[model samples]
Target: MTPDDQPFRPISVFTDIAIEARDIVRGDAHQEIPGVRVEEHQARGVRVTEVEIFEESAERLMGKPRGHYITLDVPTFKERDPELRQRLTGMLTDQLKTVIPQDPQKSILVVGLGNWNATPDALGPRVVDRILVTRHLNQIVPEDLRDRMRAVAAVAPGVLGTTGIETLDMIRGIVDQTRPDVVVAIDALAARNLDRLLGSVQIADTGIHPGSGVGNRRQGLTETSLGVPVIAIGVCTVVQSISIAQEAVQLLVEELAEDVTLYKILREMTPAEQRGLVEEVLGSRFQDLMVTPKEIDVLIDDMADVLAEALNRALQPQLDRQEWT
Candidate 1:
């Protein structure tokens, strides 16, 4: 197909460190990423009202030392392709160099928090694939030894599938054995917008929940759970089926609004015809939304690299100072 006739590519917009509830709507309304639209009001007329839980819990959970949160908003999924992910990962490493404490002895627990079997919930495994694992690196001698000074481990506690084992149980087991100074949990998260897929990466000091992907709620990995700092890195990957339909409808409306002929045709068509058209446009393909799994693998791989770099930066200084004591 010619360039114009080709399918619309996914767009992304990356914002700086500042995150307010307001940016949520602004990002959508401004089309911060081209080609996609975010409708502010919902169909039932109930608007989204965000409650700031952080302000309330700051006093309760604020005392613990943990990694800082950084958000990178890419304008399009295509822009964050595999190659871009790799470059970004390196940039993230540089950025981390600037942020993390330079502690040579500091041991960190890099927790990959998702099941390996599921594609949508595979962020943990994908990230762990790119990290510098200490155990493996320790096997080599001095000259050939990789970066083995920093402590790192990958864990994916199967949700419910582990039978009666709780997430905390697994974390506690690891902490008891490894005694890492900090823990970083990477997992997939749910986003209200379908456009967020493979584009937005959120870094938070707060811990994460493992299988919240398909709506299975569980306790989170928190300082209280493990008596250690926890960092969460995630990208929102899934969109509700209804939300996909609504987005398709919104795109259709925008197209009809600009083209008078199309508008007239849509207006004249029966409800049944409109339903058929929408169904045809949105089928099983939409179900496997977000970028292709291959694309997601690229995104996750890059995301992991960026986070690893950031962690290295954050930890290296502290490590150098021999502060793990």
Candidate 2:
């Protein structure tokens, strides 16, 4: 594509860090960013894509930098296949272990970041409910038996609307009191593509800025801010309505490209221009809207179970996979 044909600005709509990185690495936009690396792997039926941003320069280009983003692209996270579930959980746990500092006995605090009352945003709280917290057990059990379990703590800090407190502030207080070695934060993310919604999970070593999915960015939870390593895990639960419309418009453009009369007019317009036209037609009211599947309730529950099982297995290495069930 020519310079005019290429999008002039980075698509600011997507919230999933991996998707943003993929767009850059694919030369879709910002091809000048340096020190970006990408690798792909497969585990059974799962497709794993790793995108590493190694420098601040690339970070400026992609909007997220200096972190390792691992994306698990599963066809459907709600599948009933036991073997597929086992493989997916194993893959997720393995990714979590890599980011977490090596200390099987270390104290970990898993912060579930979301509003439990909303199904689309309830992935974090649900996962927190399913986690096998051993902090209390460690205090009561003898040292011999306690060694079998890790000191893991979990909390579902509700959104600012319900609690009237910054989620970061509450987490900071808990971090100071519990003094955990690491923190694992989970939340639901927004995707630019409908295909990725409820079909992918992203894990990052660089912390997370909660509420970014819906454009309400809050103070980020990071090692620099919290004084401990922060691993963020999230699944894309929704996509912006404007983005969906843009995709549909692009498909229509492609289908009409072959027409002799439309070819010249369409060829003169860039993808960005086409998207602008679509947005103009959609109007401002629909631009701010977000879209999620009607079955988001069921999807969130299944994802929470999968993520919780993975976290439990990774935190407590001594426990067998079957023990999670």
Candidate 3:
């Protein structure tokens, strides 16, 4: 069928990664964006990008609230490389330290946000299991070591589908009781590109929208919503199926461009038109489909361990490197 005869309908790609949404429209990450600042750094085997969106205009453009986003791109984070894993964990720890408050007496609550039943969505609960909770341990540890420990607590409130309660509400109840100095949330995220899935970790001061990647938009776990600062850490674990298909269409268009008739017809369609055509071809059944890697089982475990270690190291800087305590 000619590109002209295809019916057009607008479609939107859902992504929880701050950089993915911004880069889509900005064309280049290095280019100046109004009300937004972009900085890039590389260390060891990881590539780090910091994007700060402080202006309302930029917030509207990026579809993210005014906050700081730090993304670590480590292609092998999901792989079994002990030395590299240690380095990445340290890097994640360093990045996390910058946002957390400097108060020595500070207490923190770490909320893992996802359904434990689902592996792709299980990243949160899995990481929570490994976090070092010192809130109750300070009394038991030797008196000399007590001062180095920070009160830490973690919970993995099952998703609404399972618990019949809002994740935010459950968290709110906990926050009211504990009144921690800060909150850290971990969840799986969706990315526009499959390459980023399980490869990038995004740390944001903007909190997080549970299930946003899957169109389940739950209440955001943010400062305004919970009355405490929230830090969200997520790894891209899925991609919208439509995003992959749309990119495939673009590649096909380029491949077939030598044919003048086809080239003329296809070139006339705007990017949105191409996306619409892709959406139509996808139909309703595939509209809600989200794709994840085949090796997600192993990947999630590897990543969860590293991230849990990073959280432990960051929240308790004085802990021995070899010990999570």
CA lDDT of each candidate? 0.54, 0.82, 0.85
TM-score of each: 0.61, 0.90, 0.89
For 197-218, candidate 1 gives per-residue lDDT tens digits of 6655666565665655444657
What are the root-mean-square deviations of the candidates from the true structure over C-alphas? Answer: 12.2, 3.0, 4.8
lDDT of 2: 0.82
Please rank every candidate by lDDT, starting with the best.
3, 2, 1
Q: In candidate 2, residue 203 scores what lDDT?
A: 95
lDDT of 3 at 182: 97
TM-score of 3: 0.89
* Deviating ranges (above 4 Å) for candidate 1: 1-54, 57-68, 77-83, 94-100, 135-148, 162-164, 258-325
Q: How many backbone clashes does candidate 3 have?
A: 0
TM-score attained by model 2: 0.90
Tell me the lDDT of model 2 at 250. 69
| TM-score head-to-head 1 vs 2, winner | 2
